[model samples]
Structure formats: structure tokens, C-alpha cells
Target: MPYTLIKSSNPEDFVLVHRFLMQAIQRLRAAGIPLWEPEDVSVDALVKAYGTHSLYLVMDNEKTIGGVFVLEEDALFWPEIVTNDSFFFHKLVIGDDFITKGIGHRVLDALVELAKSHGKHWLRCDCHGDRPRLRNFYESFGFYFIDRKTVEGFDAARYEYPCL
Candidate 1:
């Protein structure tokens, strides 16, 4: 089945989306891969994202299974050249129960199309440089590795997909 992408700004969907994120965080922590900080997965932070960014929930049938945050500008990480032409996506997490189900590719493809429709030249994202599996996953999805850098004590690997 195809995945559904819902922007998490509606009050009716906020609770369900928040619960999905919480579940994803718990699973990630249990797997010993500490990607998100505790506060990053909190309901308050997610709600804040809804206000400042485009937060999306990936739904399988009628169930929420994953989410991501997208924005046009991210001065905190991307250099000026990239930030000027890219739609940046962050906090992309697929729920543990849905792993290996190919949901990520569908969601990412949709995001790329969204970027293209918005006239963006690139779809960009960042991940912890320490996680090879995560990096490989992005690479497998055709994201070109741009660079790896440490910012504010966090090591990150930047990737970009040309939205052509």
C-alpha cells in the first residue's frame, strides 16, 4: 500500500502524530542507536516544529508510522550556497514496526516531488556522521554526500538530492 503524508498542523492529528514520534524515539533508543536527543522527541518540540516548519506524518493505511520536518532555510547547518536553493528535511524517523518495509523511499520520493513543486533545486538533509547505517540508507536513496562537519559539538553528515 502507498503511504500517506499529512502535515501535522491540524489539531485533530497532533496527538496521533506526537504518539508516533514518541514510539519511534523509544524504539531507536532501545536499539542502542541514540540519534535524537530526549527533548527533540518531546511533544512540545514537535508542536513547536509545526509552528516553524512543515512537519509531516507518514501514514500506512490509516496508521501513523513515521514523520519528518521540512523547511526552506536552515542557517544553523547548511552553508549559504545550499541553503539558498534547498528544501531541508530533518528528524526523519520510521517507526520500528515499519522498518524494512520500504516506507522511507516512498516518503522521501514524495518529499522530493514536493520540493520540486515548490521550485526548490535540491532536497537536503543531515544525519549523525557516526551512524554508518543511516548514512548508507540516505545514500541508497540517491542522496549525494556533500560533506561531514561538526557543529556545536554534534557531528553531522550532509546529503543532497537534486530535485530535477
Candidate 2:
């Protein structure tokens, strides 16, 4: 199946984007992954809080199978204050059907490219430290573990990859 990556530019699409995110959270919970936000995170709130640029979706035939949120700093999962020069990410979910098909890597590359287009130097994210699969996955993308500790009382580690 073919796929397309689209930015959240229209309100109607973001509604689906919100549903996409809720389902992803549910899926991760089923897989025993630690998710910070409650699955009840409202679509209207997400759309209102994130505005336009922070949301993204990966679609195949208009069906959203994956989605992510990019933030400058202070994502819901990552509440600690990070210093300048890095674009941050949180709440990334790829469906079971989308797994290992290079969708995650594609989105990472796309985000890095998008950041580079804005002259950003780094792309940063936080993840559960003990999850070897998740940790190794980001490492393959050249994101190094910068701070391997619980931040803001959340058991997570910070990872960063140079974009420039």
C-alpha cells in the first residue's frame, strides 16, 4: 500500500488526527508501553493547543495509520525545561500494520528535514529508558542518549540527533 505524509493544515483532518492519537495510545497500552497522557485527551483540546505545525499524520488511502507531535520544548510527556537550538517531539504512535515498514524512520527523516528547513540544529525526544526495543530503534537513527534519567518524575531518558 502507498502512503502519504501530510502536515495538519485543515481543521477537519486534525479531528481525525486526534482520533488517530487516541487509538495509538490505546494500542501502546495494550503492548505494555508506558504512555504519559490519559487516552481521553480530547481532540478539540489537542487541536486548540497544538495549533497547526506540531501535528502530523501518515496516511494510506486517506486512512491515518500513524501520527506524531513536534514541539519546540515542553511536550506533555516531557515537561522538563530544555535549552535552545533543538526541536522536540512527543506522542509518536505507529500502528501495528505500519511497524517495521520504515514508516517511523521516514517520519523521523521528514521531521529532521522539516526542522532543517527552519534552520534548526537538533531533534530531541524522550523515551522509556528500560525499553530496549524502543531505545535501540532511536539509536539506529543516530539519536544518542544524552540524559539517561527520570525527568520531572517520569521514568524516561532523553535522546537527541543532530540535524545539521
Top-scoring candidate (TM-score): 1
Off by over 4 Å in 1: 49-53, 82-84
lDDT of 2 by residue, 32-143 (tens): 8866475335766675666567887776676777777777876554556566677887767766655666667877887788778778798888888888888888999889
Specify the highest-lDDT model's number: 1
lDDT of 1 by residue, 1-164 (tens): 56767777666455555666677768778899876666765767766754534777787787777777788887777766644677888877777677775777888888887788888999999899999988998999999999999977889999999997
lDDT of 1 at 65: 77
Judge candidate 1 at residue 101 and give its lDDT: 59
Local distance difference test values of all predictions, in order: 0.78, 0.72
Clashing pairs in 1: none
When summed lDDT is taken over every stretch of 10 residues in candidate 2, the lowest stretch is 75-84
Q: Count the backbone clashes (under 3 Å) in each candidate.
A: 0, 0
lDDT of 2: 0.72
TM agreement with the true structure for every prediction: 0.84, 0.75
